[model samples]
Target chain A: MIILIDDNPIDTFIQTKALELGGYRGRIEAFRSAEKALDYFQGISTSAIEADSFILLDIRIPSMNGFEFLDALQRLDKEVVSTFPVYFLSSSLDLEDRQRANTYPNVVGFLEKPLTRHVVAGLPGIRKAAS
Target chain B: MQISIFARKSDFQEVTHIKGLLKEWSPKVFQYGETARVGKLTREIVILYKPQLTEELIRIAAEVRILSPSCYLLVIGEGIPGMTLFHAQVNCALQLSEIGRIPELIHELKARAERITSDGGSMAMQELQEKNKELEKINFELDRFVYSASHDLRSPLTSVLGLLYLLREEVKAEGAQRYVSLMEESILKLDNIIRDIVAYSRNNRAGLQIEEIQLPELISDVEPGLRYLETGEITVSGCVKVKAAFPFSSDRNRLVTILNNLISNSIKYRHPARLPEIELNLERNGQHIVLVVSDNGIGIKEYHLEKIFDMFYRTSDHSTGSGLGLYIVRETIKKLGGTVRVESAVNQGTKFTITLPLAYA
Candidate 1:
């Protein structure tokens, strides 16, 4: 499942279309805000399920941004964090944003904006544990 | 991580004392497993505690059926144990707030010693926290430098563009119209440059110019004075209060600059055909004061939120912005020992909460 979290409805549409075009037939859940995604996570995971799944989160939002969302997710059960791979997706090519994102261990990668076919292909990766 | 280093003979009494101690710590760092140590018999010499001090602890220890694999329990106060080897473990579940990369635990030692404190581990943790805080301060300075420098330039740039506005009108005909547009384009470019300068400047300011400022009056007066693409209703949404540290005469012009820029930003990014809605709300509590400048406009995209204060960074093709408004806002706020935080949604709107010390007038 590919979950797209952003405040832009148009970008969400554009990205979803791009994902489909890229041959992603899986369910693509579009979240208008991070809070909605958080609420969704709160329910699906019980006290027992420790790990969470992957998320493509935007850094800008009304209540909580992408970094805040990552922090909140890390606070969830260890199982949740282990299961979830949170990608920091933003249109901002700001160096500070990338630097700040790197400070957090939970952040997977910082992807630039305009969800083109090439960028979408570069999104998901099975990170092999480094020796 | 929260540390409760108190020693105890048994489980029940330690549990009670630990619970009381945890009120000061956040609930996130709760310990899952707990164990207490039994003292060494090799060098043994016994010390007795009087009825009031040690007897109560002994009673609790007897109930838990305790003795540790490690011969001693920070077990100094003398308590008897039963057949079951299950000892009273001093439970220390740390409840540190989950902010980011946290310090790691260095060692787990036998708790039965006279001093039950976890010194080596805790001290290392403290050092780590201090280092993290210092790093945080540096990033904050960077952000501030970017904002202040950009903000500082806005005034002079405004003056320049203000002159251009006068010149554009003085010139005549379509031929002059082209020059007017050229001047306007230059002003826009200057604006972008100002924004970048502000963002770049934020990291450059040393922690030298710090002062308390009267912010409520500043906000009230500043928003009314600037030019925006959309001139809409700007009002104090709720009761507003002063937020600066020192009292000074109302500098209407500078205040006007701040407010004008803020509100202009609101109007600058408003949705097409929608009236700009701006609010200046103030709240003071305890030692902190908050001034929130909010607007219902086109709003900022999620990705661009952090870089909004960055120099020369623009999110859309709309070209009317100099981009230094918030950067300067941040710098000025930092100089006054204050900070700015932003919240926005793409289509909803944007809100900026600028906080300053409320220790003085």
Candidate 2:
């Protein structure tokens, strides 16, 4: 399962299309807000999830930003949090943002948008699932 | 100002008449030869002098003048020795009939002191007002720039990049691949232009924050961004040399922007036949820090060099840049209270020599 978190509905659609083109046949959950994504995470039972999941979080979101979402996510159950690896997928060209994202332990890597086929093929969770 | 009436006991009636006129002025009506109050008199002492013992009174007035340089001794009686009056720093010698002029003189002196104090305060206030107006103008321009950058610049770029990604995925024909690459190049050029616009706006909006600048670190920080193009095209990868020995102080951000633009330009316009080589040299020359950026790149024509720093002025027909890079460099250097000069030979090299004040204004 792939969880795409972005405020822009267009970017979410593009990311979904890119992921499908990259040969990933799986459930994809998209959210326009970080709060809704957090709600989805809280609803899920860790043991009930069978597949590997990952998140592509956007940095500049309305209300709660990417860093704020990371802080909120840490308050959740550690077992549930550890179930999926999070990666920052932002359009920001700021070097400071990359440095800041690296400081988060749960963050797998930082990728610049728009997520292309090449970027999708290198995902840790997707590659692990395929193998 | 303290007013003291020093009159002899024989002139009791004259002293009473003087006191009645100066009651509102709060004159400290002291009798002649009152040595006790003389020591305390300081800062604009006004003495109403009717000297009977002329020598003794002159000596006392001189002592007061020594203590309070601004003391004014106004003599009212006659036989005032001219040399003694000069030694005592007597401001005015008035006859008994001219006693009414006392109030007017005191009023004039007070007005003058007030004017001096207010002059300094008002000058500072005027400067503050001018600064406030300047800040307001900058803030307004910043707001307009941000609005346009979002609506007119980045929004369109975002849509195009996203659409291009989707288009690249859907279409994979042999002949159409070239068109797709061409479109990508144009989009990348637009993106760079937008980036430059943002930098330009930032330069105008922000004030100079002076700090110690390490040229080597600043150069390295600017290097990574220019090396790899956003469209997956690797441009000129040049060898850079730095020779900065002395500690330099300037606006760090502005310096970074200046160096970034210059170095990137060097890399962009590099000669295809030879390896790209760039050098940065910094040294103290008198009261100025001289910075030279020399590059072994495709140099500009003599006439083109003069017009290169103008806004939106592209020199070459093949140039794909925003034409804002050199303009920004010149403006930033100017803001640092510096001058920039260029020397170039076509297909050989280009060099920019910048002279900046050691202590930035």
Candidate 3:
């Protein structure tokens, strides 16, 4: 399962295409806001989490940013956070942001915009599913 | 100190005596010609009077007092039998024969000078503080403008890029594909302009954070975006010389921005005849770190070299640059207390040499 959190619908659609092009057969869930995504995560039963879930998150959003969402995620069950690997997707090329994003334990990678199939297949956790 | 002496031509001897007496004070003395002009006086003044000019002297003194209340005034003459009102205007009065009282007049002048100096100093200080506060308010407003502008411009651009991407797959006809590609190109150009605007604002507003940076890593990070061509010979040499022992402290984001803009410009303006070749050399020169980004591409002419760093300046007729790239580069470098110099000729290459203070104080 792949969860895509982005305020822009266009970005989400493009990411979906990129993931499909990268040969990911798993189900993908996308939310426009981090709050809605957190709500979805909370609503999901522990028994329903069968496969490894990966999240592609955007740093700048309307309600909550990727870091704020991670802080909120820390309050939830550790099993959910540890099971899911989160990757930040942002248009910003700020160095401080890249360094700051990596501090989150669940954050696995930080990729630049126009996420291509190569980038999707290159992610360590997503590579298995992509292949 | 400056002093103005006023008197009728008949009282020339008395003026000479006064000038002689006050010669030790090194005062720049001026002879007053008109009573109406006394208001324009900027220095302490003395009036040598006679009984006949008593009313004229009093009128001029009043005018002087009105224009410059702090200016010191002294009056000396034979005692006017009918004039009891003369004492009200001037600081001190002495009979012409009483030349010994000149010391008293000098003392009063000294005290007035001291008061004016202290008062004027405080007034100037207050004005400066007020101007500084006004400037700070303007800066704050500008920062707010940049923030709102970035949000307004960037959100739509993100959506446009997304829509273009989706439209690409849906439209399969050759002509339609060509149109979509052209639209995509235009939108990307708009996106680049928006990005540059945001970067320019951020560079101006954000406080500098000094940290140790690996030159090679920083260059490599921004290199990916600068590679406009699919295949090009872009070599980053002199990385070995910039080892861990060499301490370089600067704002990482600003440094990246400067390098990114320069590298991108090199690729963007490459000559179609030759493959784009960019070389970035970094080295430590004493207390400064010098980075040179040179490219063998369409070079800037001598006339355009000076104006290239100006905001919204483009050198080439077929250039696709946002024109803010070099301007932002120069601005960011200036903010970091660094200097950038460019050297180029037509059809030859352009080289930019930047020297930055290792640790910005």
Candidate 4:
């Protein structure tokens, strides 16, 4: 199952639907807020976070923003945050954001917004080394 | 939306029973809250029996408010004289005393339950929904993380193997140097994986140790590390100034790391045409010392703009980066109570605006 923490319901719907259309081989769950996602992070075991598990996080949120969420997680078990991969799937290409996400141990990569078939196809090997 | 209900203090006993039933059996109407209390509440309740004292009625009303807000009472002993114009005007539903008389009253009560507490129940449900969403977020992050780690890391690692394969060639070609350079990218990726592990796991741990230092001095000190970079010509337009808040603030090593990440990234992503145009503007804004690093490079695509700081994120342009460099820069900046921003477009160039708080360790 893949978790997506995006504020826009339309984006989640389109992406999940597209993934479905694309025959995305995994279950997809979407969240509109980062606070709830963070709460989930608190509940989950690092082991429960599968290698194929991915986080599609957006930086902008009302209560607890993406970066703030990360800051909160930093207080948590590093293994939980870092062991699973997180990718910044946001419309923002800000240099500082990229740097922050890249430097973060939990964050595995950064991708532009709008998950496309081309991006998916190019990403076939994203799960090759987790084991 | 706010709702108000007025019942008599004397009617509190029967109302409590109805309220509990409403909470237990019919969650649809009057929620568990906005319910009932017989004593010590601010609102007035109808008094059907004894203890109709204004204070007692007030207390019961207050209790009712604390418990069930949609539940207020009237103090009706012999008559309804004390009933306020509004209280007198309250919409009356089923009279509890006659609750047993009408079977239809049951249905009406059920419907009233739905209407009364519908918004409150919805609020609770919304919180639950939010939690479910969070569960989904963590799960997706896990998938993407593994995906990026596997693919991004594997490519370079495989390249290393390919280099090894070429090295195995009995008659090595002169392209060995080129192959080694190419292979360097993978080694960097591996090193990046290790560094990220350290940073991510230890983000909250206090690692700051501040010491006052000049920016020019810091840059000059780091220049020797650039012996490998051939930035033959460059222009730093304005007088590079020096001003830091801490007499001695921040982790020196981390500062160096941040600078190196920015400078190296600038050098690495420079436009093939521009080759070497880099600018670093340091200035102050209200509470932050902003470091603006602009590069005349190929520039980032609009799509990849937001995620440049994410780990292992090399644009489709095939730029080779440790990916963790920018991420670490961000983590360090945040630890120091600073923030970073960027502006870029394909072919136009890219600008990174970083704001560091004036206060330091």
What are the lDDT figures for the candidates, one per model? 0.51, 0.71, 0.68, 0.55
Error of 4 at B14 (Å): 15
Candidate 1 residue spans exceeding 4 A from truth: A1-131, B1-179, B191-216, B219-261, B319-324, B331-338
lDDT tens readout by residue for model 1, A15-110: 676565444655678899888887777777456433223567777666897888877777766565435766766544234566588788767766
Model 3 pairs whose backbones collide: none
TM-score against truth, every candidate: 0.32, 0.56, 0.65, 0.36
Task: Sort the candidates on lDDT, descending order.
Answer: 2, 3, 4, 1
**Worst 10-residue stretch by lDDT in candidate 3 chain A?**
A116-125
Better of 3 and 4 by DockQ: 3
- The alpha-carbon deviation from the true structure for residue A72 of candidate 3, after best TM-score superposition, in angstroms, is 0.4
Best by lDDT: 2
**What residue runs in model 2 are displaced by over 4 Å at the alpha carbon?**
A1-4, A13-30, A40-57, A67-131, B1-148, B165-170, B212-249, B273-292, B355-361
lDDT of 3 by residue, A1-131 (tens): 88999988878988998787667878999999999999988888777774667899988787798889988888887586654788888775455577798688878777666666555665665677655
Instruction: Using TM-score, rank the candidates from best to worst.
Output: 3, 2, 4, 1
RMSD of each: 24.8, 15.6, 12.1, 21.0
Question: lDDT tens digits, residues B145-166, model 1?
Answer: 5544444455345445444544
Model 2 docking grade = incorrect
Backbone clashes under 3 angstroms, per model: 48, 0, 0, 86
